[model samples]
Target: MMGVKQFPEFRSERLLDYLSTAVMVLDDHFRLMYLNPAGEVLLATSASHARGKAIRELIINADMLTEHLSAAMENGYVINQRNCRLELPDLHSLIVNCTHTPITLPGQRNGTMLELRKVEHHLRIAQEEQLITQQEATHALLRGLAHEIKNPLGGLRGAAQLLEQEIADAALKEYTRIIIGEADRLQNLMDRMLGPNDIPNMRGTNIHTILERVRELVRVEADSGLRIHQDYDPSLPELHADPDMLVQAILNIVRNAAQALEGEGEIVLRTRVQRQFNIGNRLHRLVACIQVIDNGPGIDEQLREKIFFPMITTRSDGTGLGLSIAQSLISRHQGLIECSSKPGETVFTILMPLDSKNES
Candidate 1:
């Protein structure tokens, strides 16, 4: 043992910091002794300020976690809880699989080491994959349906025009005019269902600019009662994307939010940079996250699931093509749109890769 080199304790601490799973250590009295980097990010608090705080103060419904810890401390055994809900101080809840291992100190009372691995990470990835598949399938089906409908629609409009010329009576001409008008309306609807036809002109552009353009357009359409807030990360690098398409997609989301608010609540246009983010099945080292958040009544649960599908809408006057078009546009740029809604909040997030190498 004389020549053997010992692995320093600090190296073990660093190893904890490197782990993706959140780790927290508590003393015999349940005071926080340590927090790894993942713990800080997950809890939205730094270790410097969180250390020495009572565990109950940092987590919501700490009683449930403490009950298990107390048994482990008394029995000197390890405990594992599957699918535990932990509400952080920030009010966001995460489902985690936690392990509580009681540690013994020489000639002293026992403490507990906690490891919390988020279960939502896998759940989200699976959800994204299903959503992307659904969107692609829906798009293809709609395109084929639109093409079939448009052919007869054009012929019907032409026939109506010819009939209108042949019918010298003004009364008959009015009927033909109505037919022509209806055909034109249906044609426009089918065109919208087809989504953007041109390929995206990808170029280096700032996301903030696109967001601001949408903000301004919505501000003009909406009443003064509506407020738009910008919470942007200035350090975000430019992403290679079609600014116009991004603007159109973001505008659709924002306009939908504004309409949902009924000219009242606030909408936030927020942007942030996500590191090592996944979009659909692909993973990227850097990604741009754009969020359109609104404090409205939120989308109905039944309809929220199919909000991005063609002809699915909540409003009576809505064409139902807005969100479908938006989703299609974002997909063209290799990004995906996801939504989460509750009673008081609705959020639509657009995740696009920021790395130029990821662009087509």
Candidate 2:
């Protein structure tokens, strides 16, 4: 019989390195012993730098972690937490489900193994998919409705104009004039509802310049009491987009912010580059994150969900088509917009691809 072939001793280290969930090892004293790639990413640090550091120092809320470690060490079993919060070095918090297992070997010091996986990531992805699906359906419905209404509008306006020209009595002519003016207004509204028709004339465009143009336009329209500020990354790369469409999209958001401030608080236009970001269902290597933030009464929770839909508005004078059209324009550039608001702050973020690489 041939000698039994043994694969170079099964290496658990290799398997741990390839796992997507973060895994870490701590010595009996709760000092960091090992960290895989995923662990390093979650902690936002290199494994070499993390080694020998106390677990309490590396992660926030150490009291809970100590309990889990003690349980595993004394019980010689595994302890799993359904949901826990871990504050990473980057100052962001992740809600994770963690597992702690004690490693006890003959004639060797005991150690603990930890596995952490973020729970919010999956929830966020599902929410994004649903929003995208809803937006697409709304766009299709609006296009069909606009087309049906547009033809009748033109005929009504033309007839009113002809009637006004043929009328002799000034009083009677005024009726035709009113009809013509109202028809014209309705036609303009229909055109806006139809949203952008032209394809985005994409090219390498500077994001900051597009923002500056919007800032100037808003500055002209808003009251002098309203202050507009810019926080831009000068080194940001040019994006492939239509400059005109970008202006319209960003202007819509900024204008909304200005209006929310009621003409006094500050409105900030912030731009930054994000790496390994996700937009809708697709993942990109790099993206431009532009934010329109205001220190005003935040958006109402009831209106937040429907804010992007056509004709949804909290203000009586608002037509409510601005944000809907803005979303459509940004979607044309393979991007998406997300909003988060509270009592004193509201932020509308637009994420657009900065490069063609790693598009999923």
Best by TM-score: 2
Give each model a TM-score.
0.73, 0.81
Q: What are the Cα lDDT values of the candidates?
A: 0.87, 0.86
- Per-residue lDDT for 125-241 in model 1, tens only? 899999999999999999999999999999999999998888889988999999999999889888888888987798899889898889999999999999999999999999888
What is the TM-score (0 to 1) of candidate 2? 0.81
The sequence of per-residue lDDT tens digits that candidate 2 reaches over residues 1-360 is: 122223477876677765667899988889988998778867888899999999978897777887999889989999999778887656888898999999964469898999988788667768888887899899899889988998998899899898888989999999998988898888888899999899778888999999999999999998999999899998789998899999999999999998888889998889999764567755565789999999999988889999999999888999999999999998888888899999789999998988652232
**Alpha carbon lDDT of residue 246, candidate 1?**
89
Global lDDT for candidate 2?
0.86
Candidate 2 Cα misplacement greater than 4 A, ranges? 1-38, 62-80, 89-92, 99-113, 158-173, 356-360
Cα displacement (angstroms), candidate 1, residue 295, comes to 1.5
Candidate 1 clashing pairs, residues 3+ apart or interchain: none
Q: Where does candidate 2 have its weakest 10-residue lDDT segment?
A: 1-10
Model 2: C-alpha RMSD to truth?
A: 6.5
- Candidate No. with top lDDT: 1
